[model samples]
Target: MNRISGLPRMLAVAIIGALSITALAQSNPYDKFRNREYSNKGYLSEADELKLAEQVHQELLKQFRLVEDRSLNNYINSLGQRIARRSQRPNLPWRFYVVDDKSINAFATLGGRVYVHTGLLAATRSEAQLASVLGHEIGHIVGRHGLENVKRSQKYGTLAGIATVAGAILGGQTGAGIGELAGNMIAGGYLMKHSRDAEREADFLGLYNLRDAGYNTGGMVEMFEILQRVSQSSPNALGSILASHPPASERAANTRREISEHLRGSDQRGERDSSEFERVKPSAPASSKPPRKVRPRN
Candidate 1:
C-alpha cells in the first residue's frame, strides 16, 4: 500500500470525527426516556421549569379573573404548596389559583401553574374531593405529561408544530376559551394517543400525592365516580374535563385497589377536613351582577 501523507491522513481523520459527531447529534432526543426514569426527564431543568412556571403564572393571572377572596386564595395556595413539596419536581416554583369561570374544569400548563375553576370548587363536596382533583392536576405537572405529549407530537413534523403552536395560542387565551380549544384540538385526532400506561402512572402518582397531603385516597375513586355520573347525565357539560382526561371505570377500581393495598389500616389520624375549604365559597366580582352558569362548549 502507498504511504499516506500527513495532510491526507489528517483530513481523513477529521472527516471521520465529523461524521461521528453528526451521527451522535442526529440520535433521537427521546432515547434517554427509555430508562425507568422516563417520567422525570420530560421536565425542564428545575430552574428552567420554575422560570417558565412563573411566566405561565403571570399569563394566567392576565387571562383568567383570579378569585379575589384572600382566605380562599390563601387556602388553595397552602394546600397546593403542601402537596407540591412532596412532588418529584419539588424544586420548581409551584402555584395554584382559582378561576372565576363557572365551568367544571381545571388545567395545568408547562410549568407548575395550575388553575381550578369556580364551578369545580363549588361542585366538590368535601376537602378530600377537592384535594383529589388538585392532586390529579398536579400529577400532570410533576409527571411532565404535557411535555411528553409535546415531544411525541414533534416526531410527526408539521402536524406536531401545529399542535404545539395551537397549544401555546390557546394556552394564552381565557380559561374557558383554552378549555374549549384544547378539547377540540385533542379531539381533532392528530395528536398521538396518550398511552394507557401513562394514565395509570398519573393515577397512581396522584393518589400518592393526595395521601401524602393528608387527603383520603378514596377521594380519588370518588372523583372518578362523579365524573362518570356527570358524563352519563350531561356529557356536554363536562366535555372539556373529560376530553383532557378520559375517565375509565377501571381507573377507579385500580385506585381503590392501590388504596386498600398501600394505605389501608394506616394511622390516618391527622387527616382531617380543612376549615378553609368549608369556609370558602366561589365568589363573584363586587362590580358584577349575580354569576351566570356557563355551559361547557361542545
Candidate 2:
C-alpha cells in the first residue's frame, strides 16, 4: 500500500514537472509560432525590450544626423503615431524621427522607435505612400521583430556579441568605438535583419493599419513600386533598403494579393493624398551628401 501511494506521488511530480517545462516554453512566446506564421510577442519582457531599444536608439543617435526641422519631425511623428494607434501594441511610446540621410531606408528598433530617411520620404509621391512606409515600420515594432531577433540570437548564443556592446555603451566602456560598432550593425541591418516571413508579416499588418487609420491600402503597393523604380534607376540610392528586404516586385505582388482577398474596397474609400503631405514633400529631397552604404546582413 505504501509503494502504491509512492507511485501516485511520483506520477504527480512528473505531471507537475512537464507542466512546468511547458509553461517555460510558452514564456518564450515564439514556441507557438512553430505551426503559425506570425506572433507579436517576443522572449523579452516589455521593460527589458524598451531598455534594449533605448540602448539602440542612443547608438543610432550617435551615427545619424537627424533632421532638425521641427515641422518635418512633427509631421512624421504625427503620421507614425496615427498608424501606430491601430497596431497590436497600441500603447507603446511610439516615436518617429527623420534621418537626414539620403538613402531610401526606414527601419524600426525593438521599441516604438522608427527612423525614416529623407530619401524615402522623397521617393513617395502621396501621403498614403509615405504613411504606408510609416505603417510598415510601425508594423515591425508591433511585431517586435528586433526583439524576436534578439531572442533568436540568444538562443543560438550569438546575442552576447551585441549585448556586450550594448553593455559597454551603457557602462561607458571604450566609448565611441564600442558604440560605433553597435551603430554600424544597426545601419547594416545586422542587428535588425528580420527574416522574410517577418517582412511579409509586417506587410500584412501594415496593410490593415493603413486601412484602419483611414489611409489607402494601395499605397503599400505603390511604396513597393517606388522602391522598384528606385532600384532600377538609382540602385545606389536604394541599396540599403533593397538589400535587407524582399524583392520589391515580390512584395508588391503579395500586397496586391492581400488587397484583393481581404481589402477589396479599402483603396476606393480611403484617403490617398493630403495637402499637408504636399507641403512637407518638397523638404524631403535627398541631401547633397552621399548616403553611407549600409551593408545588408541576413
Candidate 3:
C-alpha cells in the first residue's frame, strides 16, 4: 500500500517538474528567435508605430538641423518616393529628411521616415549612388529589421518593461512612452548595427529596387567603392558610417556576384549620372549648416 501511494506522489512531482520546464522555455525569447518563431507580422500595430514615429521625429527636430531648401527637398522626395513605392510597404506615408550633420551616415526609422546626412549626399558621385543608399534604408523598413530588433530586445522582459514603466512615471500621453522607447531603442538597439542576415536581405532588396527603377545596378557597386575608399584611411574615425551597413568591400563583392548570377544579360549600363543630381549635390554641405532648398516639404 505504501508503494502504490508513493507511485502517485512520484508522478505528481514529475508533472510539476515538466510544467516548470515548459514555463521556463516559454519565457526565454532567444529560444524562439533562434527557432525562427518570432512574429514577422510585426510586434506593434500600425497606429502604435505611427505614434512612435511622430514622437521620434519631434525629438529629432530639436537635436538636428534639417535642410529646408525646396529644390533639394523636392529632389530627394522624388527619388525617395520612387524607390519607396516599389517597396512592400508602399502605402506607408514615407517622409525623407536631409539631416545637416556632416557624418557619412544615414538611417531609417518606423513609419517610413528616413534621414540622410548631408555628408552622405555629398559623398555620392551620382543620383544612382544616392538611390542605392536610399534603397538600402528603405529595405530596412520593408524588411522590418527595426521591428525584428525591437522584438529581439523584448525577449529581455525586464529591459523592455522598464521602457513602459519610465513612460508611466513621466505621466504623459501614450505616445510619450512609445517615443521614449523609440529614442532608447535606436540609441542602444534597433537603429544600430544589424545582423549579417538582416544586412544581406537589405542589400538585396536595395539592389532590386535600384535595378527595377531603371537605374544601373553598377551604381551600387560604384557607391560601395567610394565608401571603401572613404574609409580606406582612418576607418576608425568613420565607424559610424558603417554602423548599420556592412563593410563596403563585402557589399561590393556581393553586389557583383549577385549581378553576374541573377541579373545576367541585363543592361549593365544605364543612366550613370545626371545633371540634375549635380545641381542638387552641393546642397548637402560638408558642414552642419542647413543647405538652401527651393521650399520645405518634409
Leading candidate by lDDT? 2
Question: Which regions of candidate 3 are displaced past 4 Å?
Answer: 1-42, 161-175, 236-241, 265-267, 286-298
TM-score of each: 0.66, 0.77, 0.76
Tell me which of candidates 2 and 3 scores higher on lDDT.
Answer: 2
Across 153-185, the per-residue lDDT of candidate 1 in tens digits comes to 556662434444444553553344434434433
Q: Alpha-carbon error at 60 in model 2, in Å?
A: 0.7
Candidate 2 ranges with C-alpha deviation above 4 Å: 1-42, 162-188, 286-298
For residues 153-268, what per-residue lDDT tens digits would candidate 2 score against the true structure? 65675534666654554464655555455565576566568888788777777888899999988888999998988888888888465457888998898778667766797877
Runs in model 1 lying further than 4 Å from the true structure:
1-43, 54-63, 158-196, 266-272, 282-298
lDDT per residue as tens, model 3, 173-262: 654555556566555645445787777777878887788777888888888888888888656534373554677898898788778767
* Local distance difference test, each candidate: 0.62, 0.76, 0.72
Candidate scoring better on TM-score of 1 and 3:
3
Span of ten consecutive residues with least summed lDDT in model 3: 29-38
